[model samples]
Target: MSHLSRTLPIKRAAHVYLVHEGQLLLVEERMDDGSIFYGLPGGKANAGETLGDAAVRQVLVETGLRVTDLMFVSLIEGELLTGTRNECYANFGRFTASFSGDLAPTDPEVVGVKWVPFEQVEGLVRYGPPPEVEERNPLIWVPTRDFVRGQPRAYYPI
Candidate 1:
């Protein structure tokens, strides 16, 4: 078998949009450069876990919020890149979820949780969902949906 065949080429992750009272729930993360950015509460799926389950588990771990009424919204597939080389392919699922609880982040990588007003979200988010996806559901945001397919986008270390 070739070396490439032994390595995993595709990565799978899921993210959720939790909205309440015209405000969206977001997790604050400190980037490598020490700058902080806000993104949805979710992460990569475990080896045997389904994407929906991963979404629920990540939200609870990152924001201390129990997600209910989880609904899958969209699937974004594209190539991940490191400079000019293709690093991997990615499959990201966007979900809308309802939650009941206060903000209390447990993940060390997560600095905190904030409920940002809908009007301010576009300005604060670095990677917003694709235009087509946003048009269908303006309330949801997927951090990896900004790149076009067939074009390599920079790989983000989570």
Candidate 2:
């Protein structure tokens, strides 16, 4: 394997946009500085784990909710580069699922999990690595919000 190919590996992940009662279920993270951040309840796909399986496992782990009816929504592709290292990040699959169970944060790093109303999403302040060092991964996550809003969808980050 070439050094460049090894270093610039493809990081594949799957994330779920789970909705419940007109609100989107999300995980809340509190930074040490007391600032709060929110994210969809999913993570990196395990080796040999299909994106659908990973999405199910991650949501259960992070939010204590069981989900089903995974529907394909979008494929988020972007390259994250930092210094000499490059990560060809591919959120190759994205899905929406319906969930059951009381909302809670099973992961210690996740402070809280709750249902966020659609109107509140804009101010939620999505984040990514520093745009300069880390090639930006969709500054605005279009798949989640658009899905929740029931809007016509095309992929782009604002």
Off by over 4 Å in 1: 1-8, 82-86, 127-158
Estimate TM-scores for all models: 0.73, 0.77
Q: Write the per-residue lDDT of candidate 2 for residues 41-66, one digit (tens) a residue.
A: 88888889999999999888898889
**Stretches of model 2 off by over 4 angstroms after superposition:** 1-7, 32-34, 81-86, 126-140, 152-158
Model 2 steric clash total: 0
The whole-model lDDT of each prediction reads 0.67, 0.69
Give per-candidate clash totals: 0, 0
lDDT of 2: 0.69
Using TM-score as the measure, the top candidate is: 2
How does model 2 score by TM-score? 0.77
Candidate 2 clashes between residue pairs 3 or more apart in a chain or in different chains: none
Best by lDDT: 2
RMSD of 2: 4.3
